[model samples]
Target chain A: MPSNIIGWARLIAGVLGLSAVAYIAVTGNYLLTALGFAAIYVVFVAALNLFMGHAGQVSFGQNAFAAIGGYGSAILTANHGWPPMLAMLASALLAALVALVVGQATLRLRGHYLAMGTLALGLISYEIAVQWEQVTGGYMGISGIPPLSIGGFAAETDRQVFLVLALAAVLACWSVWRLRRSRFGRAMGAVAGSEEAAAALGVDVARTKVITFVAAAVYASVAGSLMAHAVGYISPEVFGLHMVVVGFTMLYVGGIGTTLGPLVGAFVIGMLPEVIRGFRDVQDLVYGVVLILILIRAPGGLAGAWRR
Target chain B: MPEATLLLQFLVTGAGTGCVYGLVAIGFCVIYNASGIVNFAQGSFVMLGGVVTYSLWHALHLPLAVAALGAIIVSVALGVLTDLLVVRPLWHRRATMFVMILATLAVQIVVERLTLIVVGDAPMSLPPILSRGPIHLGPIVLDTQVAFIFAVSLLLVAGLRLFFTRTATGRAMRACSIDRDAAALLGIPVSRLVAVGFALSAAIGAIAGILVTPTQYTAYNLGVPFAISGFIAAILGGFGNPFGAFLGGLMLGITQSLATVAFGAGTRNVFSLAVLLIFLLLRPQGLLGTAKT
Candidate 1:
């Protein structure tokens, strides 16, 4: 339970992730391509942990923010020809603004009401992405999105994208670690544990909760932007209720409260198909059954076992 | 058809859809009342009813009533299974509400995937319990299925009201909902009541599924949307109020229908969810329930 162990675990995870990318890039394996894409989700699951694990709110609607971020960047860069950097920044801001509005509106609802409200909000965002074809390009999605680049070097290949995604994931994890140790992060923990007590302790409960919500939103938006550039195409289908569940699963399976939990959760969930490669026909079924067992027996996640 | 008749047709369809949602919402309210948990897997119960009934009536060639009865029994068993498998273990651990919600969501995934593996991915449907036709009354043309749905929903609401107000078991459940410890002290078997609440909720969801599947084909993934819309309806009518859930469902159904007419089908979900968000902000107590103190 020592803090140094978590720090070491995170450092090891980062090193292993980079090595995996290097291995995949050298061997040119087809299967490892998924790991590259999964790097973005590592960022997402970590972001989700900030809200659900650190801040203590259950939101089934984080997919809405991803859609906002994904579509916002895709439209600006793909359609308006904005620079990828500018579009990414602009989309993250846009998604944050939307999150602010949504969080302000529904954060007052206690418990499951907030969960349902967020779910509804996510579905609404998805509807907008799908139906507002003039902007989102409908189901066909926006394609030929420019890749992320700096100066002379463009991330034109999967290896470069993976490296970029890895940096972002590391950055996200570092920031969350910093946040967890900050005064604001402690307030989030207090608010999550007990809103009334936090308020009595003068923590500005609503404001702290909203801040965490916005932070998570920005993380998701940034991840979404990366996803847009990586795939060079974006669609509403990419962000839906299904992704929301997947993101939640990653956080839970990893362990909810810890900084290293989301990373571990995302890695395990992302690589689950490879782990269950023999159950090709019933992969989804087996995955689901394992997930249920985990939730029932080891609700704390893999990290939970370690903590115990 | 005249504009008035066109409007009436839309309203009629909306009412039918609302009835289905209300039925599901009532299920949500029942479970919510018994346990503070908002069962996200309520939708799977709906799917179970529709799919099981379809297989029984069509594949096994059972009588419609027999198939429907069998489907209801399956739903009740699944409801009990859910409590045993997911809710009880977590409740014992004293996990947070968020954990319970995640657990139910996991259940949703497990149930949907298992059902898909067994049933295949193709959508299935059943013939209407009665002969399929539209009933014309002046300017309004109503599908017989819609009329049946409305009738059944109303009957359910009334029956549930009587059950809660007149029956001893129902009274015990109400007591359990108000205070589990107090009810237990009063010699009411709180755990048994919770199981009954879930089973009853599941049975109601199944009935709604059976009623609707004749028209709208049943599929594995259909439950989440049903759960969402039904939850919205329950919230709209005020959680834990069965009659309120019914009314909320009807209102949502009508609004969705009208919204579809105005903004197109794609915006239907957006319109309903938007309305729910607005309502939650404005009147969190819902239309029928007293304000939470």
Candidate 2:
């Protein structure tokens, strides 16, 4: 069989498997709701991979962008009567613009400084979200968000929301795949490998860094919008600093810098709460242990393990 | 009613929190200097100090002084463990700075979750270590606890300054921070000092935690915000300079307090983030840190 045919076959099989999971989840409303949430995280983690895996910058502040996207769309749809989809798109673009500015400002920082700078940005964004109570509803959060709709069809139920999330996740994965195969993707790898060498080789290091940062921001924004709509509520607490750490955990567990890693990581970590439900108190403990163990034993992540 | 009293009140409270932040920031400086790895778990150690002391004193009915000591020991051990289990292994593996930083985050997660499990997630507090009631001096009114926190913070900073400059082990640690390879060549136990660095850092954080717990509520998650504030404070004063971190923390505290007046209470936290971002962009070396050659 041709290699492309094999790849297409695998993609079909994966989608079919996901559809089967969705079908089973539909019978159990709670499980479907959980999976719907997982799908949103899948998008966030995949977007993260574009930066960490491909571009090689660690953003401890992507959660801030997620909040931006979440709050941006939530406010518009909740207050202005704009369509949910349009609001999501606009918020994502806005997030990208913000990322562009932040990227230009801080991308020059090397290693530790860059990480700390992003962490500070995340803290600042969360503070802003909480303090801007007039818009974000403060700690109470904005509620009664309209369900995402298309051409008069609304996804009012968990099953429908799950379908939308899955579609979005698939699209995100597809786009990321295309991105990794592009010249820009190669440039990102070059930049990550050695910025000095990449510059020597004529790659625009700063521009590539900013573009990757903006792309990840846009991805997080969309994820946030979906989350706000799916839950019908959004708040600062939902996208706290923990999300940044958790998102990074997912990327690491699935295998950093791999196409399949994000989905795998998201699925594992997403379902993790349920898996350890019997030990309610140790849920986070389990996650912490898993994260450390993965980093130590298999820095390449689960997907990397599978390949091995 | 003197308006100056109100200003003094904010300044006093600001100084109290600022001093605690200074302590934590010094911890950041110590570890960052020694290992060149920012331990995100530094705050978790702070949380551990408070929660552990609270449990020892309140739950076990131990003496306050003894309970504080127990907390210090626990924090120091955990600090060493952080080095032995997390940092050293990763460092030996030749992990990237990104990976090492992530390792610290993992330690943070583990510490926080385990703390919640052990402490039952409730906000606990210690009985005031100082006398109750406010002391009025001219137009200023201050709590005894605030005075204790401030005085202790300054003493710790002075003690650390002497230790780093005057003591042999401390100088060894300082030498290691400056040039690990050279320090090792000079017969300094570089790895051991790194472990010592973690322990000392955690001890300072624990001290701050215990001192502040008399006036502040202790919770499992409080360490994160404290860690963040301390981090900004450290950066503001320069990453590895204890004195710089001390001054930075004080400035940050005062700014935050004043920001409450200017931007309302809700917006105060953003001040540190703003300060951090601006400093990082324009002068990453920080206020007291000399320009890197």
Candidate 3:
């Protein structure tokens, strides 16, 4: 098959799959929640792809930024009566600041050390979310969060909320696509290829990694805030290590380096539980098996396979 | 309790758990030395050790010692399987470090899920191998279980020392860790040694699980915490040093126990994680490890 034909096929299939979900959500109520969550994850996975796939760095703790963004948004809006948009922006800034400090500290380390450091960062954030009862409400979580709104227009209904989230997801993907074509993106590719070579070629390896890490954190933070507004509830469990696992699954299954990989991967993986809802007890087992098979068989991921 | 005595009690308890952490850290060292792969599934072996033993004893009515032995065998087999089925293929293909990490993580999740399916999610425990009561030593009180942990750990450490120093295979394994290409050129069965390393680590993790499960409960979800703590211990001991890992584990365990007393139970993980971050930044070479070239 010609390469363009394969690309077209993927495009059509993605559009159709997304349209089917959108139609179901618009027509009925059952799938709305799942669709909303999937949209949020789309943003999350795309941002993760920027750091992991493009930048060629490992971070087991992107969820830390997400948690920061989430708790920031939740607290600011729920307690301080701030508007949702302002709260979301504040949360994103906070996550970016955190990513800056943490990235500078950790990105210097090579390979496993970097991975371990990031993992620790994430677990520590989770511990705080659970332990800080006064702010986070502990396991009970903060509830009654206001719905996302802009300029006095609030997304109150499920359909409206899903639409807004879908728009954000699309914006996230589009930005990632644009960024991939930019000079900075190419620099990230260089860093991923070989840090020493990239450094020798004047790539400022450390700065590129830290910048990308911060960008990814901002993406995760925005997604976190979106999740808070969409669900109207915030809890530590929502942004735990499991989120990292899920993000990885989506990134790998969808095609990590590819532009549309996050969307395709997030949609497929996000709805997988619903697809296998009947096998409740075996969901995680099935996920693990599927992930392993994908790694072995389609190492480049579904998107990468499609391109080939 | 007097302040000093309470502190002493906490230290004793911490040391007991620290022994298990040391064992787990040693397992990490073995695999890392043989192959560059960091098996995130290491904790799953520990979980299996306790959970499998409980099932064999409680559900199948096996003798306690037999159950424990059976659990170790099963865990070792799984470890071998992990290497053969998961790590080996990825190793052969020269999968990126990220892929390898993700693959091991998947293995961990699969093992945890399988354990949950087989044993259910409720926590399980083994009856104490030794007598039930705490042994009072003047002002300090020590649980018999803690004593057993120390005894087992000391024996294992001594045995490992002898093996490394006195055995042909152990020396070859060490050679491979020092220089894999050189060892391979010299006709060491590097791949097989990697499998053996996995098996050794699995055995150590299982023993730790069995020893510690009597004092606390074991559940399918406990694997990640143990994995995190063990990884910290590994880093603290310097990446690939077995003895360093042991010492690191003891330090981590005691610090965590003290943190629990000083702050609260929930902050224990926070303290350890803080220690991990601080150590990673300031002392990446670890306590006993020389700077990497």
Candidate 4:
């Protein structure tokens, strides 16, 4: 049939996302606190899909960028007196810079070693965030974060920042979708599938990996910055390997090699705990179980269940 | 204490932790050798042994030795369950290597949390009678549990060497590690041997857990870091060889302890893993790698 099915799903999801925002705006149901969480997660996981799904980089450090994002935004706004809007962009840049350094150093590794090497970077970033006391506030975390706002009125009014985040998520998804169709995206994928083969065909393997990795980090960072603002708090624990695991799970459960996979995974997982309150205790457990089930049963993911 | 005594003391303490890592690393090697599957849940198995033993020993009032034995037995059983339930199904379907990684993670999360539900989230401990006695060696001081942990670990490693060298079953396991199909053709029950591989892996993991818990205590999330370190050790010593894994474990542990002293104590994990990464860059197979497929 037509690609209209995918379009309809996107439209319905957008409306639902907007309505969820409106519901929070009107009802002030702080349970939607998780909406901001979900929105930010969508941004991060979607960016992660660019590297992991499209480019074949099994990175576990997307959360490190998110950690950087939160801290970057927090520092810019909380300490440097930057506006919330400006702080967001700054966080993305900060994450990008760090990712650039890390990707360059570790991308030379092949196979599972590459995976391990990047995971090491993620762990170290997390440790630095925890141990570097005065800057990161150590383990207790940097708190009292200012919320995103339009003009004068604050965006901290419950679900308001989340509304903005959801809108941003839509834009990020659209941009990534467009990018996937771009020449650079194809080049990245080619490199991921076979670096030696791609190099033989004139692809600059190392540079492509570095750029793709940095771009992913930038996206994750911006999402993290928004999350810090939305939550009005940021913690070192938020940057741990668990976040990395969750990010990868979301991307893989949705579909690794597709444009929409991360978004769907992020949405489902993000909204899941909110759908049933008791599920909060075992939110991670459900995530793990469902993700494994999906990985096994539908290797191509939920969207992949439909054959062309 | 004298400098030599202090050095000896740290080594004693460090060796216990190192041996546990070695055992855990060996467990990782066994599975990796048998199926070419890197079992990231090796740490979870260690935690299970520690937590289960702690529960059975304290809550059920079993003898200490019996509790330790029970822990090994339970870990071995869980290893069987892991292979049969999670691994076998995945292996049967010939799931992608990536999916197998996630499946093992699923097993780890399920087992780890189920443990939290059974035992509380707090650090589970043994009786002070087992936990708080010490042994004096020259001018060096060693805790009773720590001393036993190191001694037993060395003994186990030596015993494993003999068993592998001397026994027919062990030789078959070795043969399978070389080539599964070839070993199967040589009248070896490859599948059963793989199960035994899991059993052996889990036993070592559990033994490490019992030794560690008296000192470090046990928690649901306890095994994760160990798994990461042990995996590093396995890589550092090559993926298939048990002795290389042991050396990797000791080197990693000593380096970690020294790294902590050099660059603040809390940042030890970062330094230790950094060392593993650096080592991997220099030698992809490992430091003392074995020649196996």
Candidate 5:
């Protein structure tokens, strides 16, 4: 198993996997819808890896940014009549702004404190989404969001939507891959190793953490917007704590620090429910058990193990 | 009711729920002290206490008192099992804090799903222990259940204080919290004590659930919300400080009740979460806990 051979194998497998989903989507099968969702989650998990795996931080609040992007895109496109693409970009910026403020306040904390702070941030966003009935429609949610489009070419069909989502997912992964090799990515890796040590080495640990946090938030926001456009509906539950749980499962199962881990984890986890739909009552139980087993047996995740 | 009376009523109700949060927070502190792991499954013990008691009393035709005791026992056993099956292995591996947290969360989800499968997800409740209507003290109306909560919580806190100060095992557990390696070197059964800590916390959480279930509903899904609130309470009281967690819980409960009155019930969680964010940012040491050096 030469390293280069492994790399080429992974690349080919990724292309083949995406092609399979695209084929299913073109043939009007429903599984591509799930793949579409997996694509959105890839963006989330990959961005999260930048912070958690690369920079050594914990945040239970990425869903907050997703909520912001979701509601932002929903309100902007559905109510304000902004174009969907423009709305998505605006929502991403808004998420980044919110993340900047939150990250500044919270990035000072380490370990469990950071986790708890982010968790609160997420719950606050959820509560607002549920309570702000006039704008968000409360639990009823917002629907009829315009699909993603560009200059008279709209992603109207499931295939087109999946294509758009797959592109975003690929771009998200590519950026993370590139960033991991860049100087900033090295800084993140250093910070993850030891913040005190990184600081001693002249890395601006605080600034690097804040920037990465904001970037992750932006990623989550875009995913949220894509979700809204793809599903044509947006609800508070779409970006709730469950999203955090699912994202974590994917990130860990695929390999937290690995480049292809998010994509692999997202697809495997996303498809798991459908695979075990018969055991609907025990779905969460299985997920929890599988997660624990993976953590104990293969903490590096599938992608990480493959690299080994 | 007059304005002051309405305020008093909210405070009384808030105190009742606060006591439950305090108990759950204490559970968190106990486990954290013993094992340096925050057991996210603490709330599941509370859920089990209520749900199991409901089944024993309603379906199995057991006496309510016996059922409550049985529920507490079951939760304690599950807590020990969680530590032994989940925490101990990871503890041996010296897993990172992130992995430890996620493991407990997974345990919590498993417990919740198991509860759902065995008992179903519909909300259940027990009859109030006192079975009397609300008690009137001046213009303030307090439910008999609330009074019961106060009595039990007081006794438990007193008992906990006595155990820690006077008992050898309790002191050993405290020793482990300060320094596990040192405690082990000093011949304390640190591993057993960790299980004991889990059992003690689980019992407290179960009691809280049993007491509160009479006032409201207990469903499988309520565990996460209670866990979040309890975690906030722990932070507010200062993490790993059981007494502080109790006070924090009371404060959080009162503030939430007041917020519900001021705004609507819908904004109650928002207010509490806001308090959490504020506290985490400004006063991470909490009210009673000293700042870590």
Candidate 6:
């Protein structure tokens, strides 16, 4: 396919995909409930890719942002009786704010130190989510969340929610595409390729990294909102280390910088368990083994392979 | 307990726990010094050493000495595989130092969980090869923890010293750590020796695990604490110096014990974390490594 055709095809597929999801809502396939999960993870991987793939900052705290988003959205809609739209927006903004705070302290560190700083941030968030009982509902999670509806159309089934979530994911990918072509995105690329070299060229290296961090956090938060809406509940487990691994896997496997890579990664990982429902015991081991193999052969990720 | 008694008890505990941390931290220092990458899976190696030893000796009915030997050998294999599968690939790809760390984390998680699946979720216990009775003085009591802590940590450190100082391969490993290109030019097989560094680090992890298991027992949950504690201890000591790691580990033990008395035993982790947090925020280059990318 022509490069331009590939771009157009991706756009058309996204729109049509949303319509199909809407059709799934009308038909109500319980198995398609898994797609809601895939959509959520797609957003998650895109967020991580923005930081690690594009901006060259490796953060283990996408799960933190997801937690912030999950709790922020769930509490607002579940307890405060806010509209879903407002709750989602608030959660995204909250994640961005958190990103800002963490960025200020950690952006100074580089290489291994930076990874540790972010990992620490992730651990601290885990502590807070686990320890803070009243607001977060502690380990048990906040359940009985009301499903979101567009105007009069209430999401009575997982299909409806999946459709909406998928659209959000598409928008996330669109944003990734916009970023890949933008000057800011190019600057992020420059930073990732070489920070000192970018600094020598007088790029605002620190600012660029912090901004990318905030953007990635926002993306993760938005995805978390959709995830909260889909399950009609939010829990601290959704933001744990295992979830972090899932995000990392999707982002890395999706090939990092490629706009479409996360979509591929999310589908493979999200759908794999459901696809091969058997061998539940060995699935994680298998996934891990496959991921390691992929890393060894395709360190740049699946997108890296495609690019090559 | 009287204040003096508590202090002495804590000192013993610190020495015991500190000894284990120091051993693990020494491994971290060796690997970091050799290969500029902080192997986050160092804890997994420790856990693996313990778990494998537990399985080999108790479950598979192997002799304790044979089990320990098997554990050490397997751990060395893991270290070699980690290098081949994760570290060498990232290095080969010319990945940023940060990316290699990320890869290690990825590998660590995989290894840690695989240990859990294989060993089962419950903590593993083995009968001590040596006696583990507590000997109480008038006010202060000492147990196997205190008695063996020094014997294990210091002996390993001393043994490592002799190996490095006396043997050609050991000195070659040290030289390779300093400058791989120059070491290779000087006719040392840099890649082979660096892999050896990984093997030795794994062996240290295994030995430390074996020594500590009689007191704390072996569990999958130990990996995170081990990795973080070892890293922080190594960082405290200055990332490359084994002696520094020994001091750093003891200091952590002291802080943890003191913090336990002051803030409550439950807050001991909070104490360890707080110290590392302070270090990260202020003096990150550490006692040995010095701050540089």
- Per-residue lDDT of B1-293 in model 1, one digit per residue for the tens? 58778888899999899999999999998888787778989999999999889888878999999999999999999999999888988888888887788778778777887787778778998877779678888878888888888898899989999999999999888887687788889999877787888899999999999998987899887888889999999989988888899999999999999998887898788788888888888888898988753
The deviation in Å at residue B10 for candidate 6 is 2.7
Order of the predicted models by lDDT, top scorer first: 3, 5, 2, 1, 6, 4
Q: What are the clashing pairs of model 4?
A: none
Error of 2 at B114 (Å): 2.4
Ranking by TM-score: 3, 5, 2, 1, 4, 6
DockQ of 5: 0.65
> What is the DockQ (computed on Cα atoms) for candidate 3?
0.64
lDDT of 5 by residue, B165-272 (tens): 799988887898788999999899888999999999999999989999999999987787888889889999999889999999999999999999999898778788
Model 4, A151-259: lDDT tens digits are 7877765556666877888888888888888988888878978988989988898999899899899888888888788878888877776676677677766777776
lDDT of each: 0.84, 0.86, 0.89, 0.78, 0.89, 0.79
User: Highest DockQ: which candidate?
Assistant: 5
Give TM per candidate. Answer: 0.91, 0.92, 0.94, 0.91, 0.94, 0.89
DockQ value of candidate 1: 0.60
> Model 3 — TM-score against the truth?
0.94
Relative to the true structure, candidate 3 has a C-alpha RMSD (angstroms) of 2.3
> Fraction of true inter-chain Cα contacts (below 8 Å) kept per model?
0.63, 0.69, 0.61, 0.29, 0.65, 0.33
Q: Write the per-residue lDDT of candidate 3 for residues B24-136, one digit (tens) a residue.
A: 99999999999978888899989999999999999999999999999999999999999999999989999988788889988988898888888898988888998668889
TM-score of decoy 4 = 0.91
Worst 10 residues of 3 chain B by lDDT: B125-134
Docking quality level of the chain pair in candidate 3: medium
Instruction: State the interface C-alpha RMSD of candidate 6.
Output: 2.6
Candidate 3 scores an iRMS of 1.7
After superposition, which runs of candidate 3 have C-alpha atoms over 4 Å from their true positions?
A: A1-8, A11-15, A18-22, A25-29, A278-281
What is the docking quality class of candidate 1? Answer: medium
- Model 3 agreement with the true structure over A122-175: per-residue lDDT tens digits: 877888898889989998889889999888799998888888988998999999
Arranged by DockQ with the best first, the candidates are 5, 3, 2, 1, 6, 4
